[model samples]
Target: MTTSLRSTLDFLLYDWLQAESVTSRERFVDHSRDTFDAVLDICERIAREKYAPFNRTVDTQEPHFDGEKVTLPQCTHDAQKAYAASGMLSAAQDYDIGGMQLPYTVEAAANSFFAAASVSIGSGLLTVGNANLLMVHGTELQKKVFALNEFSGRFSGTMCLSEPQAGSSLSDVATRAVPDGEGFEADPLGPRYRLKGNKMWISAGEHELTDNIIHLVLAKIPGPDGKLVPGTKGISLFIVPKKLVDTEGNLTGVRNDVALAGLNHKLGWRGTTNTLLNFGEGKYPVGGEAGAVGYLVGQPGKGLHCMFHMMNEARIGVGMAATMLGLAGYYASLDYARNRPQGRPVQGPKAAAGAAPAVVKDAAQPQVRIIEHADVKRMLLAQKAYGEGALALNLYCARLVDEMHTGEAALADDARMLLEVLTPIAKSWPSEWCLEANSLAIQIHGGYGYTRDFPVEQYWRDNRLNMIHEGTHGIQAMDLLGRKVLMEGGRGLTLLASRINATIERAIQVPALAAHANALGAALQQVGAATKAAWATGQPADALANAVPYMQAFGHTVLAWIWLDVASAALASDADQAQPSTAGRMGAMRYFFHYELPKIGAWLQVVSSRDDTCAAFPEESF
Candidate 1:
């Protein structure tokens, strides 16, 4: 039997898991269809039956900390255990690491399900994955002493970069790491130095969830003149464990100098514990002959680059989580619209009393389901376009990662450069747009969305955290303009433009997509011209002032191109059972071109504008 258009679209986009194929650019995610289906099936079942059931409970019963210990809901613990037991925690690792060896694309797709189910629970695994990335990059001794033991449940890990004084700017960080004795005294196991400073907004900072916490801390080391080095250059990474371990990696009791000063009560993501940590108190090790116990991860002065190993992965993960929550909101809204009947359509007049209704008893009524309303459909379509397109983008990036590792030298280099350039966009655009989808989902539910009665509100709250997750929208914009696009002589931007041009050329050949292709091509040219002009001006600040518009314009153009590509592929599929599915895809493509593609003109206009409007207003003027 032929499925509905929505169902067919979902199956083709996600179920087939076509984004993981890396052997050929055109044949990405082409193998193991059955394995992909099984994984997705498991995800859906776990999400519906296990994770979704406790979301409300977990949100209401946020993790609480007593003087001695922190307590979390049992369901959250159980869910984490279930996730680990299911082998999902190691899904992207090699088969030797007790992993299923699933491709990064598949892992990313599956993560969306987990995040949508429970963002808080999902966060723990993300931290673990980030730690795993460090393990891959760190020295063998570091991995064996810290990483391996942590993966085996002896220690849990957390990334510590933000301090009370330095939130986003690392150069302003004041944390100090001084050598003392054989090791230091602040170490919980004794023999480590004193780590004296305050760290803020640390996720999974203090929890009874794990035996010990491995904090990947960043601190400044003294330079040549006995003065702290300026900027990230002087900063170094330390694998500071909550409990001290011996040479054999055996864990000892008590805690390190790090103490949870307070907990942050956030507007969203209450399920994950956020803490303010004070490292090195008088009682612990500061001024006590010993310094904070620490082992450097890599060479001093290269900490930021090493941390990027984790940060890049975290950025991609943030986008995936945001997209998932958006998808959840969309599906929930769709379900509600299907079930909830509302007011009559404006086109039809009121029914006369005692007269037979114009509509049949079982037929469509003048007052149709909310899903049928034009405005509601608009919101739903917007959500679909953003969520699905972002999903495709992430998977596409993941495939690029694989290509970078396993493809030929030229292909690998191209993939690496392209992925690096798109990283900020892949992270920021979805984080922003998918959140918009969540907001629309709430609006779709009207008043019910504002209350706890529906999941849409929670989805919005969870997704809200993603804006600040890996990096803020402004930070991403700066990276895109100041660094990624402009650095290396604008090679990244040029490469991306060439790819978009290829898509446009191919799309123009398809009669169904010719208009969208033409419109997108014109917008691309406008963006390219503006970008070149900004670069020529040599005023990075002025150039970056228009970065956000470039991001949006380019994001939309790429998504339009991807939709066209999808439509082209669907049109060429076998006509047997895929015909109806292809027809639905064609309809969506038509809708996108008509409703969504037209906005490219406005985005282009904004991108091409000078920075005069923004520069005109001074800080005091605001």
Candidate 2:
């Protein structure tokens, strides 16, 4: 494993999880630093060996639809099988259910390796998130039938929410789930319904990598009038399997009514199959019906709430994916900078006034490695700040999830609240900033970074999809300022502030960190003030018009808090003096506090002023 990767995981397990008692709970009894390190090592080894080798191949030879079946590189299946056999597919599940029962924090850290190595083959992420949703909301039978298969890797899963027309606006979901009258009672999942709709942008939607594909679809169930309800209130979730399964979770070798309309060629993440799917189009009916049979997973009219369970998990997963890609790019660029010798010191005596002062031998005045140049170092440092800091923020969120799952009730409740508020920032910040880091990685690589020969370009391409994966930047921004901050009378925001302030107070005890702590405190206050000012205008349009800016400022402030925590951890480590990693942490912290923190002020200005510059402009003007 890379030093950066191991250090970050250590920081999570030791500096954060144990420190916060996230792994001290009864449920996480077997979790220790050794076990966590072991899991990370396995993930890193498998990721490097299996997934990394086929990353480029998967991207270039994306799933091909041959009118009869979809074909993928054999390596995709090989890599997936390796992952499933490693037991990470069920790493965080219960022991009775064949899980390793690792803490979510460790599981998240382990997953980052796969994301960094080959996000293309990271289809398991969705499957796990889907299984988690079923574990939370599905009945015992549903768990046995679908979730277990998914966790075992026999059946991969996907969250089927977006449609060809509805996109992220689930209220506009037009998919209908009519009750399967006579034969519905035989189904074990629940009262079965015939789902008839088309879903779009479904990743891993259809693949031959697994034996079966389970889709957790959101659709509307009709009321007494036999007419579909108009909004999300009518939405409900369903377990729609690609192949018919018996009550005992055995595949019956019968294809369901689901059909792949086609594959949507994407600009990025081409490694994973993105599909347009037609359900109940009558291509193959399970029980002489034109609609696909689906078993209800949750109550009708509560589908959005049920899906949010998966969406939120996937959102954090997306953030981690983004962060890993940024880190991957950073390491790649750093290696390139060190080896690809170029330009000399900008102030190398100006060539002695063009007198061609003795050409120093290559051995003496050898061209300095790009890393030795100030500008290249600046970009590299920026990437380190963004990549590592975003990573810390992600693991921190994962630790919060651990607390929510295992800590005391009150502490768990507080963790939930903070996660609710932080989720949007956690998702959006990395999707935005880490992509920026990838861009810097490319710049650090100069012209070669733009070429297909380098992995940095692919990293950028893969990461570009995350911005719109779980949600768009604008949507997350709206959620952050328009909802999360103000929810429960601002409890989440308050809790988050208290936590950051606690870190600030602790930092003040150390002279080296006091200045950064003060800067963060000021930034935190700016966010609070902006939060108040933005919402003061009762007009939601006015308040939300500058949501993007609010998210930017708020996200930066959150990163500042995370960086401070990281710096404190580095300082407190048992190293006799400042090790290179400690120095690197301090340097990154200084970069963020000096360069990135101040930009938040400009963003806050836009938010606090309730700037209508864009929102007030007429749509026709576009």
Instruction: Give the number of the best model, judged by lDDT.
Output: 2
lDDT tens digits by residue: candidate 1, 235-352 = 8777777776765677765456677787899877888888988776543553343344566667777778778887888888888888778888888888888888887665444579
TM-score of each: 0.89, 0.96
lDDT of 2 at 541: 91
RMSD of 1: 5.1
The C-alpha local distance difference test score for the whole of candidate 1 amounts to: 0.72
User: Clash number for model 2?
Assistant: 0
The reply for model 2, stretches above 4 Å from the true place, is: 19-23, 183-186, 348-364, 574-577
Each candidate: RMSD = 5.1, 2.9
Give lDDT for model 2.
0.88
Give Cα-based local distance difference scores for all models.
0.72, 0.88
Q: Candidate 2, residues 1-622: lDDT per residue as tens digits?
A: 2666877677656765463354567787676667777888888889989988888998899889998689988998889999999999999898999998787888888889899888877848889999999999999989988899889998899999999898989889889998788777566679889999999999998888888899999999888998888878889999999998888888898999999999999877877999999999999977677999889987778888989999999999999999999999999999999899986654433465658755433445658889998899899999999999998899889888888988789999999999999999889999999999999999999999999989999999999998898989999999988899989999999999999999999999998899999999999999999888997868899899999999999999999999998888888883443478788888999999998999998999989999889977999999
